[model samples]
Target: MRVIKLTIYEIIFIIVCITINLFKNGMGLERLLLPLIIIILFGNLFCKSNLEIKKNREFIYAFILVFFLYMSIQGYYDYTNVSKNNYSLFKALLIQLPITMTVFAAYIFGIKIKNFNWRISLTSLLLVLLVWLSIEILPIIRYVRLNSITDLIKLIIINIPIKIYYPSLVEEVIFRGLCFSGLLAIGLSEDKSNIIQAIVFGLIHILNYEQFSINIILLIVPQIYIGYLIGKIYINTKSLTPCIILHALLDSI
Candidate 1:
């Protein structure tokens, strides 16, 4: 693995990018640009040599194309939200169907699947359940006391697509697949990669920040902390499927 570190110039560039991201709400395109720049710069840091590339032509091509597609769809979604023209949850999910389908297609056609470790996945599932219960158990009890089983089932069915597409697949592909993997490829250790990506995951929620307050800190902490768990799971499993399911389950409950 090629380990690359930021030079002074690259650090300065990142600082500038962050400054631009701060104005992302006021200038919508800046949000998109910052992520693209990040992916390109960091991704290229540990890219393979020409011989390696030639040997893995198919894999490299697919990976690059899919990464770009993921970035584009995510950028558009961010743009819509920032511009205050975001679709309803249901409609937004409907819009994501095509993009999600494309991503799955790329995975199927471009990548090879190896042995998946179900044990690691199960551990991830347990962690997800624990996390969910910690946050939502009280509300869930209230809901159960007030609602019938049929009503609960209906609610779950209705939210399934949204939960799967948003928090599970799309978000995982972007953060764990793109950001975390890119960091690892650039020679970061697993722990460092997880932490960096988790922090970035948390910072993205700043877009939803209403004001500087204790509540904002609380909101960001959970997102970042959960992101760290998800990243660690992805690294352990070397597969996104488990994390996707786990994330959807967490969000649904």
Candidate 2:
């Protein structure tokens, strides 16, 4: 299974050549404002869902309302927790809100939501509390190395479930759900579109930094491939269910 997954990952990796355009000014939201807005507008305009977007704005709004409420709670948590305050984990979740809420709203309205075999999304998220606590309480797990006071604190900080989940969902929807599927719907073939979208998703992380090192490329490699796998799982199963689980598991491991 590992080998097969790696071969498919390699094929997609080949379509992508690495070109690190370093940004020395440091990352900021302003950098992507115009382009990101344009993409959001375009996707909202043309996305083909089972719901009549114009007619179902109310449903969409309701979902966004709930989502925003959750986000507000997360933000409050961030304000209270010093480490979270530094990470802007709430703000990171906030950044992806507009699109993620839209996809979910569409799902609520009987869209062309895919039907998969295993049929589970957020199962991994459900396990997060257990996995995270295990990392703390258990001693044998390799990733659970509580070497120092600060390290232990960081482990607690990073392992927060809401910190992990909301952003992942937004990323999957924007990258795999919208960009990949939208491109495929227009003209790009499933594999090509997926691979390209995965590349873009991976690039978002690597390029957001000031300078892209070879190590950065290496770090992004597995993630990009995982993004590709999410794309493939969505396309092949014709559902978003597995993407969520696969992504959560990859991050968990």
Candidate 3:
């Protein structure tokens, strides 16, 4: 019964994703198919999450739930907030208060990055190149277009401090670095975990599109894959440094 429930829940999520995909009518089915591929892979490989995360389950759930609440609220504001007195930025920051609070609380509560500086440096350099090179060479990759790649870079560099910083970094750290990896540590494969994470990432933007825009599949599939890549970096490196740096670099591109 538990397995059936989980499977049914996942099926509904995928159907919604597909509904958004077909309705958008812009991108190819290829993008839509990617997540299905991931789901199958996940069922085969990572369905049984590791028992270890159970040890720290309380901290993980608390941290993730808090981040979820903050992001979910801000995501809504990003869609519905109307500005008159130039207070949107301030209001936006106010919405983001949870991220700062969580990181500090997590620290005080004994969640520390094990190797600190060394981990940060190595991940930073590698992610800078990993994401940078991928975007730079996209023309030859047969997957992403050059302009799209450039737009990604521009978003990271230009958008971060000016329009969206804490949201991207804090959310990605929690979702990709924390939720995604924690899932993988037990039962989810890298690919399975990535798309699931990315779908949530993409959903945060769903309403921002005009009611008719269906290009969401393109957005969602890449996000999930990207989440997976960042998760892989953190898991292998045992730190979030590379994932954060690569994410910043990738989104910037």
Q: What ranges in model 3 sit over 4 Å off?
A: 1-55, 82-118, 122-124, 136-164, 185-191, 210-219
Question: Which residue window of length 10 is worst by lDDT in model 1?
Answer: 46-55
- Report the lDDT of model 2 for residue 150: 64
Model 2 Cα lDDT, one tens digit per residue, 124-180 = 233323322332233324344536656745654564455236556656655665566
Clashing pairs in 2: none
For candidate 3, the TM-score is 0.54
lDDT-better candidate, 1 vs 2: 1
Residue 34 Cα positional deviation in candidate 1, in Å, after optimal superposition: 35
lDDT of 1 at 7: 47
lDDT computed for candidate 1: 0.55
lDDT agreement with native, every candidate: 0.55, 0.46, 0.49
How big is the RMSD of model 3? 8.5
Q: lDDT score, residue 12, model 3?
A: 62
Superposed on all Cα atoms, model 2 deviates from the true structure by an RMSD in Å of 12.8
Which portions of model 1 miss their true places by more than 4 Å?
1-90, 98-131, 209-218
TM-score of every candidate relative to the true structure: 0.54, 0.46, 0.54
> Model 3, residue 77: what's the lDDT?
54
